[model samples]
Target: MSHTVVIKDIRNVTHDVKRIRLEKPSGYSFTPGQATEVAVDRDGWRDEKRPFTFTSLESDSVLEFIIKIYPDHDGVTEQIGQLTEGDSLIIGDPWGTIEYKEEGVFLAGGAGVTPFIAILRDLHNKGEIGNNQLIFSNKTEEDIILKNEFESILGSQFINVITREEPAGDHVFLDGEIGKDFLKSQINDFGQAFYVCGPDAFNESIMDALKELGADPEALVFEE
Candidate 1:
């Protein structure tokens, strides 16, 4: 099913990222880590559709999406950057396989953190965030999305890996590859579920590393 939603607000979270708030349709419900496909102006785009993860808490009546506007990309992201408040978009039913479990580690890169943002927010609000850890990576410190929010919810449980920034505190922001040693140092258990999201290469690398670290293949969840 599809619903027509009005753009209620827009805020810039980074140079290339925007947090878009939509007026939710009546009787809509979604899980924390679900996603929806959006279509702006029926004929305004070539593909006319794009998938975006929900960044707002599930309890909120409205829907929020954190979208990364890629100027060089050929598709909805570029078109989405041109939208303003008062515009209307077509949104599909929420769907995704990334469900929040009681104990796990969330590994995200760049815009991939959007889905987990909602999950963490919900868990924090319910005082259930203590059971999970988050490892978020980006090229630079400025590229991290919802930095303050993540820090507040995750506290010492959050690990930020900025590949291009100098090492800060006890965390080392390094380049090259992320290996089992790095994962072991940050995560408490390889027996717990591992949720990874990112670009193709990043996801693949992390999945491989988790396997090498003795993570069960059945306990890993990722976008298909």
Candidate 2:
């Protein structure tokens, strides 16, 4: 069933991204990395549902979503950019294709990092972020979301890649793609779990690269 929730707060993460806090329904609950259909509560818009990952931990009293809005397109996300506090949203029950099964390397592109946020935070809270690594790619440094939080949680293990800019030290990349050579140099064990998410093309390319690198296909978790 779908629940109608009022927006508790709205804030900007970047020029084109927003972080929204919504009221949690009485019986609502969801695990990290899960998502569901969401639509504006206004008339004629309630059916235009889009899937968004939960950026908030389950223990929190409110629900949160980190959304990347594109003002150039007159789509749902464009409308989302115009929303404000106290606006209502229709959210469906939680469902997910990505879940944390083990600690390993996480590869995310742009807003794809949303799902991994809660997963890592949950682990961090429990002091179980053991040997986990995150390789996040963005168009620029400004596009990286929750940068400080990721740095604090993963420390030196958090690696950021700026594709549109020059690479430096650990935040490096060649051709804007995390290919076999880069993977080999950063990750030591191919047997560990690999979590990946991004656009369809990004997902396919990364998964292909991982498979070619001898990473077990069964251990690679991603949005399907």
Candidate 3:
């Protein structure tokens, strides 16, 4: 089922990323890390569906999405960037993406962290955030979404790795990529649930590293 939702609010989280809140349909529900296909409810873009993770909790009165827009692509996200409070969107039924099975380390790159946002929030609300950690990598500090929120929730368990630009902390990742050495140094145990979401290359590399570190294949969860 598809719901025609009106945009209630839209605010920039970064230069290219926007946090959009939409009206939630009555009885709508979704798991913490699920996503839905969204389409601009405009004449020329109504059929162009793009999958976006839900950043808002299931109990929230409104649905939210943290989207990164690439203006040069001229795609659905670009169109979404142009939308405002009064605009409407066509969102599909809830679909599973990164289902959180248990507490463990989360490896995320860039906007891939969106799916984990709600998951972590859910855990925090339920007092299950302990034993869960987030290792997020971004090109620069400006690209880190909800930095303060994540840090507040995870405390010392949240690790931020800035690859391209100088970071505010000493924990910058100067190597430009996360590999076996880095994983070994940061992650002490590999037997827990491992959630990874990022570009194809990042996902592949991280999966390989986790596998090499003896992480259980069945415990690895990622977006399909």
Pick the lDDT winner. 3
Residues 1-224 of candidate 3: C-alpha lDDT, one tens digit per residue: 99999999999999999999999999999999999999999999989999999999989999999999999998999999999999999999999999988889999999999999999999999999988989999998888899899989999999999889777764556557888889899999999999999999999999999999999999999998
Model 1 score (lDDT): 0.85
Candidates in order have lDDT scores of 0.85, 0.90, 0.93
**All candidates: TM-score:** 0.94, 0.96, 0.98
Worst 10-residue lDDT window for candidate 2 reads: 167-176
Least lDDT summed over 10 consecutive residues: which range in candidate 3?
A: 166-175
Pairs of colliding residues, candidate 3? none
lDDT of 2 by residue, 37-98 (tens): 99988878899999999999889999999999988988889888889999999999999769
RMSD after CA superposition, every candidate = 1.7, 1.4, 0.9
Ranking by lDDT: 3, 2, 1
Better of 1 and 3 by TM-score: 3
Better of 1 and 2 by lDDT: 2
TM-score between model 3 and native: 0.98
Q: How many backbone clashes does candidate 3 have?
A: 0
Most accurate candidate by TM-score: 3
- Give the Cα-based TM-score of candidate 1 against the true structure: 0.94
